[model samples]
Every structure is written in C-alpha cells, then in structure tokens.
Target: MDLGIDRQALVPVVQQIISAVAQWIRNSGASPGTRLPSIRQVALDNLLSQSSVIEAFERMVAQGLLVSKHGSGFVVAQPSVLHEGQWYEGAEREWGAFVDNPMGELKLGCGWLPDAWRESDDISYAIREVTRTDTAGLFNYSTPLGLLALREQLLKRLSQIHIATHLDRILTTAGASHAQDLLIRTLLKAGDCVVVETPGYGNLYRQLAFHGVQLLQVPRTQGGPDLSALEALLQRHRPKCLFINSLYHNPTGTSLNRTVAERLLELAHRENFLIIEEDVFGDLQHASCTRLSALPHDDRVIYVASFSKTLSSALRVGFLSASTVIIAQLASLKTLTGFGTSRFAEAVVTTLLANGTYRKWVQRLRKRLRTQMAATLQVLEDEEWEVFAKPAGGMFLWARPGVGDRSRVQACARRLGVLLSPGALFSPTGEPSDWLRINVAYAADQRALALFRAMGPARSTSTILKTTSV
Candidate 1:
C-alpha cells in the first residue's frame, strides 16, 4: 500500500494504518477487484511493524472496505461507496501504469530518475537518522504549515535562487501535486474558469476536471505561454487563475525567460487572475533561470516546488510559497484535506537539508543529468527525429516521430517491452500529437537505444536499425 501511515498517532499504530488505507480506498476510486500491496511491502515502505499492518488489513476487511481472497492478498470490496466524482481517471492511470511497469521494459516514459540513479545510501541514512532522533514525527500529525525546520531550510534554498521569501509564506505538502490540489480546492468552485497549458502536465489536467473547473488551454512557446492567446483567454473567460510550469517546464524542458516572466506577471495583475507557477523542476535546471515569483512586489504568483524530482519521489515532500494571506488560506485547505504532509517526510528532508547533503546530492545529480541530456539529444539528432527544443537541462526531451504511424510505432514498441510517453497525455483536452517525452536518465541504456532504433526510428522510416553507439 502506498498509503501514508502515521506511526506516532496517539491511537494504535494499527488504527492509524487502517485510517490511511480506508481513506485511500474511498478517495482513490479503486475498483472492486483492485489488489492492495502485500502486507510485507506496506510494512517495509512505511516503517511499521508487520503485525500492525496485518491487523489494519483485517480491520479494513471487517469494515467492508477491503476483502481477502485466498492467496490473492487484500482486495477492494465491491459496491465501494467511494468519494463523489471520478478521482482516478485516465491521466492518473497513465502515470500509475509507468510506476507499476515491469522492470523488463525500457521505461523511457517515467517521470523520475530510475532507481539505480538515486543515492540509496544517502536516502536510507537520512530515513534511519530521522526515525531514530525525531520520535514525534513517527506518531504526531504535521503542523498546518508543516515542520518549521523544513520550511527554514527551504527559505535558504529559495534565497540561493534569488526567490526571496519568509517561512510564513511557505506551506509544505505531500508533493507538488498536493500543493496544486490544495490551491484548486481552496480557490476554485465546481464551474469556475481556469487556464492551463495546451501541452501541459496531464495529471493536473485530470485533477482540474475532477474539481469540475473549466480549463482554457493556452498554447506554449519555447520561452513561455503564448502571451497573445493568454490575454485573449483572460479577456474572454476571465479565469480564476493560470497554472504553468515556469522554470525547466515539464515535457519540453524549457524555462521562462525574464521578459516573458515580467509580461506574465503584468497580465496577471491587469487581467485580475492569479498565476500558479509550478517550479517543480527549478532545482534541476543547470542555469539560474528567472521564475515568475522573482517579481514578488505583488502577490499574484504562487510558487510551487518539489524535492521529489531531485531527491526521492517516494518521500512525497513539496511546498508552496506565496503571500501570508494566500498561504493562510491554502494551509487551512490542507488541514481540511489530509491534515498536512507526512511528518516523517518533513523530518527526513529537514535532516538532509540541515546537514548540507541535500545540496550535494542535487549538484551531483544535475551533473549526471546534463551528461545524459547531451547524449540523448545526440542520439535523437542522429536518428533525424524533430525535437521540441534542446533542453537547457532537465529529464524530458519532447520529440516528434519525424515519420511513420506514430500510434502503430508506439504499440510496436510496447509489445517489445518498451514504454513511451504518448503526447496526448500532455494536452489539456487529450489532443493527439506525434510528440514523445523521453527520460534522459533511461536513454543511456543500450537495450533501450536498440529498441528505439528498431521499433521507433527504424519502423518510422522503413529502414534497418544501425547497431552502432547511440
């Protein structure tokens, strides 16, 4: 179970586990036969006693939230009285499919760095140290604004990038997604209008739909959003806000220049709509790029960031920085949602940040990614595929097939145990395109390169694949 288990609850640990799992089932839109993770996996992931996890599962079974089949592990019960609305949709399922992908596949579609790329020793050490020293994190709920220590550390990080802000303006979240969710629930009504990038994060597109918000799709340029289209959208619909990836934007791996950032902020003020700038990839950028929040004289932009991409996605630690008024509102929304982010997650990150290991890890990780990005770009150029743009520095390389039945080529690749991020998922309206998002880290794999040659470029052009170096 990828459920957030609180170990330090005043209630029994088993009860805490039960609450987490039950809430997930109710909200996740899990199907009748959906199988939960094994008791051992859940125990190991959450650092809980195996007996406690087992007890929790048994209680869930009794509560009709789960059922145990003979040797099939715990399954979601039929006729599930889940939360209203479709919480789990196609976009989420797409991301989950990649997560649950079999190791045998060439996972060029994944969002995070591969498991082999992570500093397991450093991460494990942080987890162990936090578990040993921070007894309160294990049992207690996090503060509404999250751990002060973590926020303090984040303040320093923002300073390094010229994003000046105080701790009070920050609110920690489960991840960047959670921070976005909190803002959506807090600021938007069921039928409110909001603007999203045309080729944007699909997960956010689905999430906005879940909230029943009307999304105005703004096309993106290499530098930033198409400003003329954005102005027209604002004039026509007057959306409540505009959600965007500012620095090192996802899929395309492009950052907003200072001129564009200033223009966006001007539009936000004149048009009277908020700007939710998602800087999740900020730390990953090789250069110090200008973020929208850099012009913070007015509180129109809310800065969202995550450690998941740079550190460990499993930790689910992220935060948002905004004016005190906005932070207070979003923090309350967070309280009404999941109480706050995991205390354990906050403590683990705080420890790493305080000791300066977090900085060192990201620095090394960025260097490695820069190397991979260059090699991946070279391979794509050699194959004559059209790249969206050469990334300054980031994980993804959005590219077109240049030739062939894109759908057929994708299907063929998948049959051979290779996964590609289809372009349709990145569009707000699920519009089809020839673009594919490639993960730079995984591009180094010789097997993946061979598969790409044979199943991708080769199939597209009806030519034999060369077995030379990628």
Candidate 2:
C-alpha cells in the first residue's frame, strides 16, 4: 500500500497490490517475522475492495511469500523456489534431475501432472484444519496398518472396483515403491527368479538387480502379459513372483481384459507363483475394472496403489491390499524398518477422499489426461509414428518409429531441448528399440507437439545423444 495507484494501467487491482507488496518486501529487506499490513487497511489505502486484498494475500500465502496468523494478520515469509541440485547416477537420480528444471525441454517422457494443474485451495484448507485440531495426526505415530479412517476410505475405493478387502488386510507404506520393497523383502530371497514385464516400469530393473534377484522377462501385449511366454517362463525358472500392471500399464498405456485376468489367475494357480499387481494408475483409467486382486481369493495376488500420481507425490501415501497373512508380514516389516508412515499425510489424504474432493479431482485428471492423450496421438499419427494401442485414459502412449531412425530422432529431439524416453529404457534387456513412451500429460505442451512435428526429414540425424546412454 506504500505505492500510489495506477488505475489507467491495464493490470487488475489484485495483481497490482500483489506486485506492490512483493516489491515492498524486497526493497525493505523484510525479515521472517516482519509484519505485513492488515487486509482491511490495504484495501482502504488502495481504494479497493477487501476481497481484492484478501485474494492477493491468499495467493502470497500459497506461494510462501507470506504467512497468515489467526488474529494478528499476515506476516512475511521466504519466497518459494524450484528444486536445484547436481545430477547423480542412478535411475532415481536421473528422473529427479529431469524434473528439477528442464528449461525449454519438452518433458514428453515425464509421468506426472504439471505443477500448475494441482488444486491448492483444498490442500491448503486441509493442512490448516489438520494443524488446528488434529491431535492424532500431529502427536502420535500412525498404526502399522495406517490410519483406520484412511484405510477404510481406501477399502471403499477397492469395493468400487469390485475388489472386496477388509481393513485388517491393508497396510500403508511410503508409496507404491515402498510397498514393492516390502513385498520383495518378505517374500523372496537372493538368487530368486522373478518374472518381470518386458518394456515395463523402467526403475524396477535396477531395483530388482540391486536386491540380487534374477529377472525373467515376459513380453506384454495389449491385453496383458503374453500368457504363452509367461507359462514358458514359469515352467523354465519356477519364479517366486510376477510384477504386472493391469490397468493403464506404464510406458505402454495398455489394460488387461477379463479373459486375460482369468487366464492369468488360472495359470498362477496351476504354476504356484504369486503375482504383484502394480495398479498405481488404476484410478485414472477410462474403463476396464478387471483386476487380478478382484479375481478369486487374495492368496495369489498382491495389489499396490498410491495417491502420488493423482495427489501430491510429496505426501507419499500408498497402501498394499492382500491376504491377511501377507498384510501381517508387510505391516511387521514396515514397523521394523520405518516404524510407521506419516500420520499427518495419511490424515490429509483421508480428509480429501472422505470429503469427495479427491474423487472429483481424479475425474478432472482423467478428463485432462484423455484430452492430452488424443492430442499427442494425433500429433504422433500425423508424423507417421506407429502407436502400439489407443489408450482410453492414461498418461503414456508407446509407439515405434515410422518415418525416422530412433537414435537420430532422439538425438535431434535433445538438440531442440526436448527430452524423450526411448523404448530401450523400458525393456528389461536394455536392447535398442524403435519405440518411445510419450507421457500424455507432458506432451500436452505446445513445445512437445512442435518437437514431435519437428522430427521430419528436414532435421539432421546427427546430434549429442547419438552415443550417449540414458
């Protein structure tokens, strides 16, 4: 409010006030506890409505430029910034670096929603409520099975998909990856043979190898895993477990059908090997509710799901649904390893789900994902790239090269500041491939569309990624 008004300018009053306050904070070299003017005073001083000042200050609070106290009013806070760090070696570190700040690079391979797409008001409200009166959330450690209310809410989600599960059989973890880690620790030993989908979740390759488990690759089709190839693997290696994605499969965006699910369970019963279903993208699927966890009893299949994809990844709220025995073992391991998941995070997600905000957000997310998918596919098709399947709803679209060399196309993309995930990363053997997995959410950017279209005959084949490995 220190600055005079510029009504003749095109800027909105709210934005102008925001700009004035931001400039004042920096020019004054405001310390952390420095007080901001009251909303009413700012409104009166600027000759604007209280709502205008409220909106401006609310935005500042969300951006961490200001903090609001109950009765005293708003105070100065540090400015928010994006994550910054040096690149490190490892699949996890590689992805971390890619997302930190891609500059102008098109994130066609990233699997997350852009930061601008999230709904902050509801999250902010939930956080405030938790801090206000959330005793169980703030003071006590979460039960090994996690907050009952959250687990019960998740049980309702499971029921929606026809997968009947009880709270006693559910154990919460840090995320889906943590769930998988617990399963690996409890069920299998070193040198154990594990059936992994070829061209599947890329990071799992390193994780399994790190645990000293031998991987048996099974090629996945549009319906599911190639049953013929799978049965042969079971016959050859007698593996202990199979990790599969049934709905909106990662890197491929393919789903499994009832026939495939039934056939898979039948074969599992015949072969006596367990299946770990990674349905992390289940909530975002367009259709098809057939799950290995839904079929028969829960003896042979373990289901892992998370809120990371649809909700905030920083929260890390995920759970495992399986038989009572498996759940007990997982809960014990979770207790031994980390004691418990964050009670506050679980409570926040629980509130979102129970209040119906989370479902509405997921529905909106699905719609956005579908739109992005259609647009990405159209661009790829226009370029004569061969898509593996038409995904109904999901983040990924796998395709093979049609008009350009895979290596050269990727190299050219890098030069244009476009990061692309080549097919070789998805495969267990790391063999060269003509395929690429384009994340629909990331591809929605115009830069990505232009990048895909730019890979025509005009662009040169030689570039930096020609010999460099991902």
Candidate 3:
C-alpha cells in the first residue's frame, strides 16, 4: 500500500504505481502467494483514483506477473522472471505432460512428425535382416565410437550434406537431441554465452538455458538470420557458440541462402565460436536446389541432424560431424552420458542403408510431404494467413497471426482440438507475439480448418491501427 508515483514524467501515474509495487514485492522477500495491497488501499496510499489502481492491477494480472483471488486482491503469481533463465526445467515439465497421456489427446501442441512418417517399417526390415545375418552384434553394446558400419554410413551422408567427414570425425548418439546435449556438456560451461535465433526451437532454447548458458538471440530474416543484428551481438557479447538451424530453420521455415551462409560462417570464424548446425529437417525439403549448410569442411562447424522428422523420431539415430578435436571430446562426453546410441537401431540403419531402401523411403516421404505442404499452404492461403511461402524445404510454416493476440489464437486452437505453438514460447522472456509456428506435415483435416475459423477475425484491428498510427 506504500507504493508511490511521480507525476512529473510522461509515464502515466498507473504505470509508475504498478512498477513501484512490483519492485517492492520483489525486494521485500515476500513469497509468491503473498497478497498484494487492495485496490482501494493502493489508490488511497498513492492519492490516485480507485479506477487507475484497478486498471493497473488488471494489467499486471494480464501479464501473468500477478494473480487475483476473488476474495483476497492480487498476489505475486510468478515472483521470479525465470522463463529465460531456467527454461530446461520448464521444458521438462512440458515434456512430462506430453508423456503422461501422449495419444489420449489430439496433441498438435508439440511439433511431432506423424506416426506414419517414422522409419518403423524400414527399421523393422533392417532388424529382421540383421537378425538373419548376425544376432551376436545386435545383442551387444555398441563401441564407444558407435558401430563402425553405422559410422561409415553417417560419414557418407555427411559428405552428401556438404560436410566431408571421416568415420573418425563422426560419432553417434541416441538422437540428435542427445548429440546436442552431449555437445553442450562437453564444450560449454555454466554461464557461457550462446547465441541462438529469435523465435527458434524451444527445446534447444530450453536445453541451453537449463544448462545455465546465457542465451543471446538474433532475429530471423526472410533468407536467414538478421546479419546486422547478429554482428552487433557478436561485437557486444562474443558468445561461446552460435546455434543455428541453417537448412529449413525451425519455427520460421526460412532457409539460409549461400550468401547468408557465407556471412554466418565468416562471423563464426571471426568470433572464435563454433557453429552448432541442427538440420533435423534437412531431408524434408522438396526443392531441387540444395539448402545451404554451415559445414564447409571447416573444423568450426559441428553438424548435427536426425531421422526424427525424415523417418521415425523413435529410431533415435542422430549423428555429429565435427573436427577431430570436437568429435573426440563429444565421443568422450557421449560415453559418460548415455554410453552410445542403440546398437540394434544402428544395425538396422546400417542394414537399410546397405539395401538402398533408406533412399527409397526418403523419396516416398519427401513426395508425400511436398504434397501435404501444398495442401497445407492452400488451406492457409485460402484463410489469408501470412507465411514465408518460399521456404525451399521443411515441414513447418512460420506465420504471423496478423494482428490477433497469439494467446487468443492458441486458446482458440485448443478449444477446437487443434493446438498451435504460440510465438512467445520461442522468446527469452516468453513475451507475447502475433506469430505462430505450425507444422504442415500433419494432414490438413477439417478439424484444422475449424480451428482457424475459431480465430474469428483474420487481422487484429488494434495491431493494424497501431501500425498506421506509428
């Protein structure tokens, strides 16, 4: 109730009061559940009208920093601004929810590749083939360096992806996610600064934040990252690593062109930081032009990709190709962490590769994805949604909700049993946005159309008005 405001400045009286009260609660060592001052009492103490105090409290509640009880007035809801600082623990909670009842609900929330898109069939055939040929190796634990044959296959694929790596430079993990985790554990220390793209993949964001690495963000551009902003950040922070999704960048679906790729590589070289390229969606691109890759046979690039989107996410076959120095460190880290990827799965992947079925599977899946992407795009375009249509390849369509409150859009999607990923989840502060990241690989069903209908108006009038005024 002791909150005070200065009327001399341009800032409104209510905002000053709100900030003062918020800071007081923060500094007072009060628990999150501690009740805040009553609106009337706050108004009286600050010599402000009751309406102003009420509006201030309402704004705080809307921001999720405060919670109001029907009988008790407002209380601090989230006392700590830990969304950015401790995102991994939060991500763990979210994943826990996913696992709790995965198929029970229409889980459009997480960007999971459809079950039919997985390599279960290909994997099954490989397993059978491997069992028929050699059952002994399948049952045993893989070498710390991974199966030699699987490593060879991985190296060959890396060469096709513009990274010329030897078996010695490739290491296997349980999944691409595992590779990323191991890399962070091996190379980065707590509090090390890591730069990621704004509106980036939340899992990576969570993992980096969870490990206590300071995250710096550069805005995503039409073709790649905002280079000027990235350079400015490079000048200011000099981060330890730069994590990028160069080919079909996540959430935004913007691929890096050759020019953008060269600039990014140049920055990484000058900054003395490694580039962690997560190209999980590289195989899904339908375009004839090959997407750009950070691995230019450079030791500074740690290339990582998975079968998560291309094949079966459950197959958990992810490879890392880097310089001998990093590959050695990451291998050691993998040994200490999960030992190695599944031996049976590696044997299966090897068998499939040897048989040439893996390529056929990718061709079929890519064709289907291209068709689905078109259908998805048609539906969205029919709805007048704004998206980057030139994304050469990827499952997702990065879109802005055009003037609508993203939270409202999310809520509407939920009500229609079609969940969407709100753009705020991609930001450091979980700030609200008009953008939404959507996975188009999932068949565009009537349910999805219904969900869009729930969005009410297409453009947010307020947002358009604000822009006009600006």
Candidate 4:
C-alpha cells in the first residue's frame, strides 16, 4: 500500500504514518478483520525506523482500530454495535437498548462511571455514620415529605442558588427524573399541551408522552429556548405546562440568559401556566442566575434537581422545591405512585451534607470536569471537527462531523473502538443527525485524546449545527 507520506511535513512522522494508513484502509475497501504487515516489514518498505511503525501500530491498537495477538500480529478490530436513537420495543425497553453481551467489559456507547468516581467508600462511611446516629428514622419508611433535616440542608443549598424555597415545600424523590414524573403527573392531564425544546432529552419527553401529554415543539437557539415561538405556542395551544431545562439544557448544552429568564417568567404569569424546569444539569451552569423552575414566582415554577449528575449515578437522590400548596398536591400524587424515596439513600446524602464532604467533592468534581472538557474540545478542534456551543460548565460537547453518513460514522466509530453517543438519541423520532454529544468525563488523558483524533469525523451535512447561545 502506498502511504503518500511527506517526510518533510511538520505533522510528526508517527501521526502522518497513522493518518496515511487509516486513509488507505478506508479507500482500499478492505473490510474489518484484514491484517496488515509486521512492523519490521512496514519499516523496510517505508525505509523508516522500526520504532516509528511500532508506535503507529500501538496507537491504532489503543484506539480500538486494530487488535494485537501474542504469536501472530495486529489485525483490523471488530466494529462496535452501539444502539442509537429513541425506539422503544416494548414497555420495558427504550432508546439505546443495551443488552449485556458475554464480552462483559467491551462497551462503547454509554457513559460509564469511571473507577475513580465509583470509589464509594466515603459514601459507605457517611451512610453508616448517619444510620448509627439517626437510628429511629432509618428503620421506618421515609416520610412522603422527606426527612426534615435533609430538607433543611437542601433549602440551604437552594438559598445559595438564589431560590428562596421553604423547607416544608420541598419533596425529595428517587432522582431528578423522578421529580419530573411526579410534577408531570400532578400538573398535566391526558391531551394537555406540553412545550419541549427540540432535540432535548429524549427520555424526559418520552416519559411525558407516555403519560398522554400532547407535545409542542419549541425550537432552541443558542441564547436558549426560542421565546418568540414559545409565546406563539402558549397563545395557540394554551398548553398546561412548559417543560424546560433553562440552564445547561441537555443535548444542546445551552442555557438561557437572565433577560430571557425574566421574559419567560413574565410569559408564564400572563399565560397562567406552570413551568417544570428539569434541573439535572444546573450544577454545570456558568451563570449567576437561579435556574428556572415550575414555580419561579407566584408558585408557578417547580424546581427539580438531583445528586446523580453531580455525584454517583447509583445514588438516585432528587428533590423538588415549590410552594406549600403545590407541594401538598404533589405529595398526594407521590403516595399513589411508587413508594417514597429510599431511607438509606436520603440518610447517606444527609450525612454527606452535614459533614461538609459533599461540598468538597462537588468542588473537586467541577475542577476535574472543567479540565477534562477543555482537553476534549482541544482534541476535536485539533482535528477540525465542527463543534456546537461552548458550554460554560456542562459535561458534554455537541459535535458534528465534517463529512460522512452519521450512521456509518457511528458504525465506523464502533469499529474504530471508540464509543460515541450519536446525535439522533436526543430526538424523539430517532432521525439521524450529523452530530454527536461527547462526554468529556470519559476521555481525560493523552491516550484518550489520541484515540479521539484517530477516529476521524462524523457524518457531515450541508446545513451545519450552530452552538447554542446563552
């Protein structure tokens, strides 16, 4: 194979070699499982040092593009089979249907909790200590209203974010999504209008639709949800609730500005509708304003947030803050639903809050996430991949490929051994986009970056995606 390498090029000899080899593989119509020459043979053919070829091969192997065998040599790697888009097969199965295969550790599409984040010894310690001290509450079923001490702690946090919610009005649920469901159940009836951001979180929308709510699509701009369109929908449909993620909105990684937030609250007041702001990504906000809730004022904003995003995902702890009246209604709805939040989880979280470890951990996490995000962005930019908005504090970057079929690109990424969350997963109809949401937390080092660069671009389109404005 002719590599067409420029020995004088400044792109580093090893990188050039890898790029040439990769381009050749794509153009040659060679299927995966094809084997290449040995390092010594390649070195001889290219008239280069053996170490250069070895380095290139090593890099390819790490990126999942090539696999190495002990006695034989390196061969093309197997293609990854990650599911993309939202297509529920049955009541139990949903988007990205993940079936655990026999090759246990070989997963590429989902964002997993790295070992560093899963060290839950500290969590264990906190839970044990709290259960010991609060023995009485530990044994009984948790109050539907949530533990008083935990509510007080949550209120203190709400206060820090400029949300002046009372302790009595707060209700803790299994997680942010749980809080979302309870609010939806309480406010929306079947066929009621619910405005959602286009290309928003698919599962949240799916949950709302499953409850028989009529969905109205509001186009999202970089500054946040398109207020003009939202106003039109509010007047046209007279919807029951506006489901928004005003800060660090999912998939797009966009947030609303203070001006827009005020205008949104004004519209809600005039329209006489409620706002259910999913606050899963609120902790990643770079702004100074409080997150928009179902009751921003006059008891119209219901604020939902969870520790799953900021802390461990296994700790499914989420809460909602609103007026006493709404809280009472939600509390009634919660009872008819599943059993209340876990006593153990709440007690453990409460313990973490009391000892101040949660705050410390959050600070450390933010710092690490920020660094990792920058590194991921730099790697993408280096390869000239088209990126959407520059998120202030979110953990993901929405990227579009320069050229190729989105599905094919995804297929290629799997074959290359790099797992990517395809853009179509966020959409309701499962329509493919030339975009992908990259989790910065996954690739935090040089090895990860190198793998990213070797994977190439996603499916390119004539109309490119712009960054969401904040």
Using lDDT as the measure, which candidate wins?
Answer: 1
lDDT for position 348 in model 1: 94
Q: List the residue pairs that clash in candidate 2.
A: none
lDDT agreement with native, every candidate:
0.79, 0.78, 0.70, 0.69
**Superposed model 2: Cα runs more than 4 Å off:** 1-93, 102-104, 457-470
Q: What is model 2's C-alpha RMSD? A: 14.1
Q: What is the lDDT of residue 97 in candidate 4?
A: 25
Please list the Cα RMSD from the true structure of every candidate, rounded to 1 decimal place: 11.6, 14.1, 10.3, 10.0
Which digits, one per residue and each the tens of the lDDT, describe model 3 over residues 207-233?
887799999988888777889999999
lDDT of 4: 0.69
In candidate 1, what are the lDDT values of residues 150-183, reduced to their tens digit? 9999999888888888989999999999989889
Candidate 4 local lDDT, 1-470, one digit each (tens): 54544554334567656656764565565566778888888888778888988998897786566788887788776533112232332212212223432212223234433555654877989877977787875677778888777898998888878887787889999998788888888878898877888777877777887898888988777777888889888777888778787776677667777777788889888988888877777765544644665234778887888888776678798998888988998888876786677777888888888889888877777777788778777877776778788777677777765555553453344333344556566666556677776667776644345435544444133212111000
TM-score of 2: 0.77
Poorly placed runs, candidate 3 (over 4 Å) = 1-90, 97-104, 288-297, 456-470
Deviation in angstroms for 212 in model 2?
0.8
Error of 2 at 7 (Å): 40
Candidate 2 lDDT, tens digit per residue, 1-470? 55444564333556556646765775577777678778888888778888988998997676556889888899987432111111112234337536764244566777777778899898887788788868779888999999998999999999999887899988888899889999999998889989998879877776787788899999989999998998887777788888999998988999888888998888888888899999889999766667899889448999999999889898999999988998988889999999899999999998899899899999899998888788888878887678899888888899865556664565445444566676667777666678888888887666676556656433345522332111
lDDT of 1: 0.79
Q: At residue 86, what lDDT does model 3 achieve? A: 36
